[model samples]
Target: MAPACEPLPVQLGAPSTADPHARYARLREAGPVHPARLPDGTVCWLVTRYEEARKALAHPCLSTDPAHASPKYEHPPWEHGPPQALLAEAAGRHVLHSDPPAHDRLRNLVNRAFGTPRSAFWRRDVERIVDGALARLAGRDEPELLSGFALPVALAVISEVLGVPHALRARLEESAEALVTVGGRPATPNAARAAAGEVIRLMTGLFREKRAAPADDLLSDLASAADEEGGPLDEGDLIATACLLLFTGYETVAYALCNSVINLLVRPDQLAAARASPALLASAIDELLRFEGPGDSAALRYTTASVRLGDVDIPRGECVLVSIQSANRDRCRFAEPERLDISREPGDHLAFGHGIHHCVGAPLARLEIEVALHRLLTRFPALRLAVDATELEWHHLMPLRSARSLPVRL
Candidate 1:
């Protein structure tokens, strides 16, 4: 008979210190699952192991509905308020936070837009976007990688894919930042509300435009999907899905690109290796995802019923936060997990997550990051941080983890 694993000791209500790696490591070593406290003082389970984390994420007992769970678990501040009408109109209609069936339906419709043929078709467009963004950074002694390259590349690709108006792209970017900020750093109540309004307004306009024109973008596909069998998702659902895609597509991939560039620049040998052989670029990107992919914490999953994981018993409606950052670093899963080895193939990292809710835009993200990195490295051989690495600050309290700025000198 197999020995029962001991219950992990968990720290509930831990302070929001800058780095929690020490505490997280302790929890991982003790057991696969443990109890933890959220910023709003709510208690939940934190899953760390590779296997358990995968099971917990795919478990049917876990629900993604914010309403059934604690209000404190809301991502943006507006989620807790009178629910931005546009966002509410779109939430359940999309797959990001929906359960099966509805999730399946919505995902199928959107999947058509991201199919192999469509993705292959977009390769030329993606390259154009990447080249244009990198070109702007060329011949400069110092370039703000985050603002000058990564952000723009990601924003352009996603915006163009969704057929977002070029002029409103900047506004959408601001709203996206504000949306992430509301759930992330501490902000004044008014500031949070204002950011939420901006996101709601931007998405509302895009939804209206898609409805009118029905172009060749993802938004149009979604808008047209409403007539499909299973009853079409309403305006709110459409808006919510679009907003969610924009936020997920832009923020996470942008940060990962910045981190990957920093990683390669710091290790010239790896950069040289990647340059000599382009095949290494994919592996290098995987390493970066394992080392510093965004979403330091996993998406919140609420328990639908009482369930036992290891020695811990999670109650119904209890929030479970999977630490992708921690899981990626689990020693049992990856050898020398702490070290960044560009040549080493990471079997599978949860950076894109696991199960049904895994990132839908991953293929697109991979293509964008790969192209951006290849061009940035090939174009600027002397790329180095313009500012001290330690001086850069990460966006605290945000579910998506990334540096606020990455200043680089070519």
Candidate 2:
């Protein structure tokens, strides 16, 4: 069983300083669903235990639409001074924000882009990018692996998949990184909002161009997406989807890649096991993803009706945040859940998500992480953390990931 620790009571929205998984474990011990609030003072529930979270995530009574589920709900703004239309579109229309028929409509349109055969094509490019980046680091004394190697590989593959122009890719990537990573520095509401707006503006322009002159890119494909009836998604939905693809699409993979590399570096036994047997690489990636998945609570799922989750009757219209991290570590769900064991066989893991909203890109994500870890370990057999592992700074407060940079010597 995980150790017991209770979070000190604080204002509903205040960020916790303790490690995120530790916080989740503590919260899970308390109960499956606990009360919390968004930064903008909206009351919400945190669903922490494995079974409750799995059920809650797929429960029809729960909703992803904040507008309908919790109309009065307010969230900290991603950017200031943006037009309300842009903000509203961003807030309400994406595939992540819809439920049921609407969610299926939006998801179906974009799902083919990530189909198995399509992902295979992407994997080739991903490998090429990973190889090129590693080659660049061949003779360097020390290269910050996250920035120099991992981030570039993710950006290159995603950009190519999205059909971002070579000329505009750099700027687009910078703005997307700012929006996704929150400046790739310390995060604050204002900074995060500005980053979001900047990326939104760039995507808006790209969408406009693609609609006018269709190209052979993801944007072009989305630009022309239509059913025999009217289009399934509107202009706003397209923009939101595009932004979602670019912004969210790369961050998780990058974090997992960095985290996996760091884990191998620190745990020599596991590292040696992986290096000794190529067959172990795939298992190591899956375990790494489960042990330290980059994502946090599902963005928003409010109760439409009074719902009973683990004996707690959450009132109607209350927002619920399902902790993917917490569920993965629940002892009842896995034997010795706290410990990392690559030999463990596959089981139900919520690292990506569950039910109707399971991540569309799980296949691609696994491919990237597996390929990156295998190549990095093989190429840099002597790879070691340049600074002490304790000395490496972690961006713990962010909901998306814990580490900012993983500095290493080749």
Candidate 3:
């Protein structure tokens, strides 16, 4: 059993975009879990330490299905309509949000699409895309990394995998941005709704196309699976799943890659070490994920029964926010938690989450970042930041964290 400590008073309004380590350190020192406020003023139990977070995330009693919890515990940006409803209705039929038997079935169907055969094919494709993107960056003096490279690479890879039409990629990009922005205070319900509608329409059309003439891509695999299981998913489920995959698959990798680059450029020695030895790049990537990962918080999990984490007794239906950023840097799990040590041996990190809900795209994400970084370093040996690191803008809202634009001198 994990050790318990005294519960501390919750910090109400810390800046979401600011470095969270200081605040998380305070919380961890005080206890395994404590109360914290969401962006939209929803109060939740912030689970900080690695062991406690893992337990909570994988706890069968804590439900991922939003329907089991009351409205008061709904995720923030409430005005945009219930996220659970939107996910169930617009994105895919049933996905990470669903519980047990249903979750298993849905996950199995999608898992077939991302099997070893698909990954083997994508690995080569990812290498080619990364090499091309880095080559484009070589000629420029100061390239905006996010815009010029990371975003495009991630978008292209996901688009190719999903078999989305080349002509529709621009609209997909626009919709992804709109969807992410919905998490902020200036919520654009109408625009987000429109984007969701467009995504659904586009994916629905693709599903039909695949049903008529199956291809080797992920969509065809999903269509075929659906047919084998009696029928394809309902239109709403299909759309929701496709949209979720489009945004989730690309956004996480884009931000993570950008963060990794920013970390490497800021720490010259680490960059040198990685450049000098390619094998170390994989461990360096793990450290980067722990040090400044793209996800600030895990997807929301609601309590099914009263439970005590450390000194706090969280009641049934209360929301819990697993601070992935904090857990990755816990002093208990890592020595000198705040420092970036590229060569450290990997143990267990929440970078891809844990238990049954672990990120399904972990393999793809790792391949993209590793290939992208290796190619960039090899191509442009003197790559450096264009401006002072402090001047670069950072994204705050949305569960995903990233730099707005990373300007780099190659």
Candidate 4:
């Protein structure tokens, strides 16, 4: 093997989101860790195997904060537009990018307002939103599932939870699409900046509105804390948290739902089994996540100190990308990992991640998926792809797997 200081010639530019699993399988088979160069010309360690990926995710030295990055780490692997500093200034102070006490404080506030119990409480709202979307889909001759049904349902539920009025929901969705599609499409730098500006403008106004007239919603609760001395949030924290929620809350859920539907639709037996029993459907959710979760990897992690993962040694101040999708499908960890077995035991999947930074919205995402899938399948018994499955194109966004558009014949 070459010296740890020398990066391999192989480039892990962007995994083809449509069929990333085959590539991840090869990487995992080769070894647990590989030195790779990203598209932005950054050399980093990519963790491919299950055990190493899980440990790396929770490793103390692997930090999510950008401050821990090496001085030479110029470009962020995920985004191209705007300097990392500018993006950080706009939306980087949330729980996802902190450590220890600060992360605890921010996460605790989210949990208090949006925990499992709170997510369960939103079931009625989710069902109502999903049913309404399905109704609209029913009217169209050939509906685009991602935008027409899934995306709208996900956005509406989250908007209601955040106390966003009906008037602002469409605008919120547009700005969010702009922010997330940066990597997926060829977008100008200003696209992200403009979208960020719009989000900040709307959120700032909403924060003020919420403070003046508190409501029984997550935003109101967060805004209230920001008003107090030594409270959990400040203006920066609130805005950043809002960005985090807005981007992840709806986007990830919608993508996962689309992915799940695609998976089930292709496998007639799984679809039949899922529709046959609600209990089986619930168990199948994790299987679907393990088979093809929305995110291919967790957030980019930086090494605070030299660390050994498996047989490879990585130096301090370097980048580490852990493939959550690869880990979930590791044959060593899961028997017959490639097959989509809905009856397989559900725990230990890294779809929502592991450790302290595990997605706070797991419960909510799962709830949305269950409600949306159940309603969708029951509503359209003959639902099928409008075009051949092979013709569907997927977004190239790393860590996010989504079809560009899902056309369905209902």
Best by TM-score: 4
lDDT of 2 by residue, 1-410 (tens): 23325543212323433466667777788777777655555556777899998998899898877665655555422221122224345534777777878788778767865662555577688788889999999999888877787777888877887778789888766655554553235435565567667766777787778878977667777777743255456777767776666655677778878888887788888889888887888866778878888776666777789889987898887777777778899999989988887778768888888888888778778888888888888999899999887776665432565466777888
What total of clashing residue pairs does each candidate reach? Answer: 5, 2, 8, 0
lDDT (Cα, 0-100) at 159 in candidate 3? 87
Report clash pairs, candidate 2.
78-193, 79-193
Candidate 4 whole-model C-alpha lDDT, 0 to 1? 0.79
Give the range where candidate 3 is weakest over 10 consecutive residues by summed lDDT.
76-85
Pick by lDDT: which candidate is best?
A: 4
Model 4 per-residue lDDT tens digits across residues 288-338: 999988886788889999989999889999999888888999999999999
lDDT of 1 by residue, 148-169 (tens): 7787778889888888888888
Candidate 2 stretches greater than 4 Å from native: 1-18, 37-42, 69-92, 182-195, 212-216, 227-232
> How close is each model in CA RMSD to the real structure?
4.1, 3.7, 3.3, 2.9
Better of 3 and 4 by lDDT: 4
Q: List the residue pairs that clash in candidate 4.
A: none
